[model samples]
Target: MNLKYLIFIIILITGITLAEETKQKAVLVTGASSGIGLKVTEYLIKSGFYVYAGARKEEDLKRLDAMKNTTSVRLDVTVQSDIDAAVKFVQSQNRGLFGIVNNAGVGVFGKMSEVPDKDILWIHDVNVMGPHRVNRAFIPLLKESMGRTTIIGSISGYVTSAESGAYSMSKFAVEAYTESLADDLRETGIHVGIVDPGAYKSKIRAKVTMFNLTGSYDLNQELTEEQKKVLNAAKERNNKLKEPDEVAEAVIHLMTSDKPKLRYMVAPTIGAAEVTMKTTLGRVVQLNADQQFEYTRDELVAFLDELLKENSSEL
Candidate 1:
């Protein structure tokens, strides 16, 4: 080849390498097939971070693969082998793993008394231990990068719903686990946080009302007239709810911040859950004079930060 052609080839290769190097940090987003997880993946890619998008479905993988610089992972957080495979895939990529969004979760609607043991067991496996599973598998990678970790939580973590017993139980467990994990990793360079979101237009809505996947305790069981009323109310309310962009922004902030709060309450409403948190945190924790019961995401996060700090210390 002539010198001019060789120079042109070198420039092309150099430009490609530069572009690749710009996305040096890769973040793993679980349950990335839809809803908040999908939105988070998109935001991260647009923000110029390489994303390892995890999904249990083939269609989700295909969609994520079409995006530039994203690795589509076949993952079911409850399954050990899937977690192992995802870790291996990230290893193959040779990119610096900067974070993991433990966003995979599901909800069920039933009274605590009526729900079967197996139902709660299955849920605990997914919502409670799932984050643990992902963390355990990705610890080495997270350690290498001193990465940040964010747990996608719910208002139910602190405030129980009248009908969603199994889901509330699991989320409460996740609440404790997130705090413990953060405390354990405090000394390490890695940062750990949680975002407890209220009603958001996500799969959780349909999962509870429509799909009803909780085998023994699901819709197959007959509902009381009261239960049906509650179901209808929830359906109506959730249907009218819009997807909370603030929730996604909150997660992204937690993942990317130089110094992130331990937890955030992503409720854009004066939710009943917020009321419970207010009372509990007020009694047990310090109060910020500027804080009040509110719908603003920033105020809620501030309120939660104080409460989570108290929880961590007690832990």
Candidate 2:
């Protein structure tokens, strides 16, 4: 090669390398005003990824935008116009999205027979349909970038107790949605996953309490003695619970890992994990009972071990 031509090639390669080194991946996180979403946003920023933090309130948008490498988008998961605007805004940035964390969710605790239909709908709108809407709107960009998408699920999908039917139902729906979505996108490079967190310190309970008592999101209303006790207990329990930083870590793994798992159950305690697993296994046992080809306990254990081995493989 001629000396001058070789030098020009060297300079061209160096410029390309510099450009690649400075490039940053962008991720959109819904419900980023507080709790898990906020933690994920902060951690992503710390890890040097650009973030489009989605929040509904004006103050939250301002706060998020003030962060380095962060842009706050006004996104209310239940509203289609807001979602469309968000999609447009993201496209306008021209960074091209790399990942999406569907973390916006709501919780309601009430008896199935007594909970108002509107309350159930409200929770479903935020918890279940929220992810669906956001996913549908952003899937084009995700496909363009071959990006990853994760929904923030809950172990409540597996273990439901009294007065948690609605919330549990929505989570169970998310579990199904994630599985089906993964299957649908199997050929695409886009990865789909869910992070199910257990009892992380969050504002979900406070919101639930306020909605259950006052039928609105307002927290300034007067409280009765019973309501006060409930709020106090919830506050105390939340203070005892750990932050959801691990859940944020799980999300980061899903976004960056070459071989990310489809499901990440992030429980705050071993007992919570055990209960959730047992509840899942109990359902399996129930399904086997009185069936034509019921498996024995040993057979089930062997099958579980086989599954574990398969999941451990680099597929």
Q: Give the number of the best model, judged by lDDT.
A: 2
Compared with the true structure, what per-residue lDDT tens digits does model 2 show for residues 148-233?
A: 99999999989998899999999999999999999999888889999999999888878777887777776678999998888778
- lDDT scores for all predictions? 0.80, 0.91
Candidate 1 — what's its lDDT?
A: 0.80
Off by over 4 Å in 1: 1-8, 11-19, 211-236, 282-315
lDDT of 1 by residue, 36-104 (tens): 898888888877789999998787799999998788999999999999988888898778689999998
What are the runs in model 2 whose C-alpha is more than 4 Å off? 1-22, 224-226
User: Looking at candidate 1, what is the lDDT of residue 157?
Assistant: 80
> Which candidate has the top score in TM-score?
2
Error of 1 at 315 (Å): 21
| Candidate 2, residue 105: lDDT | 89
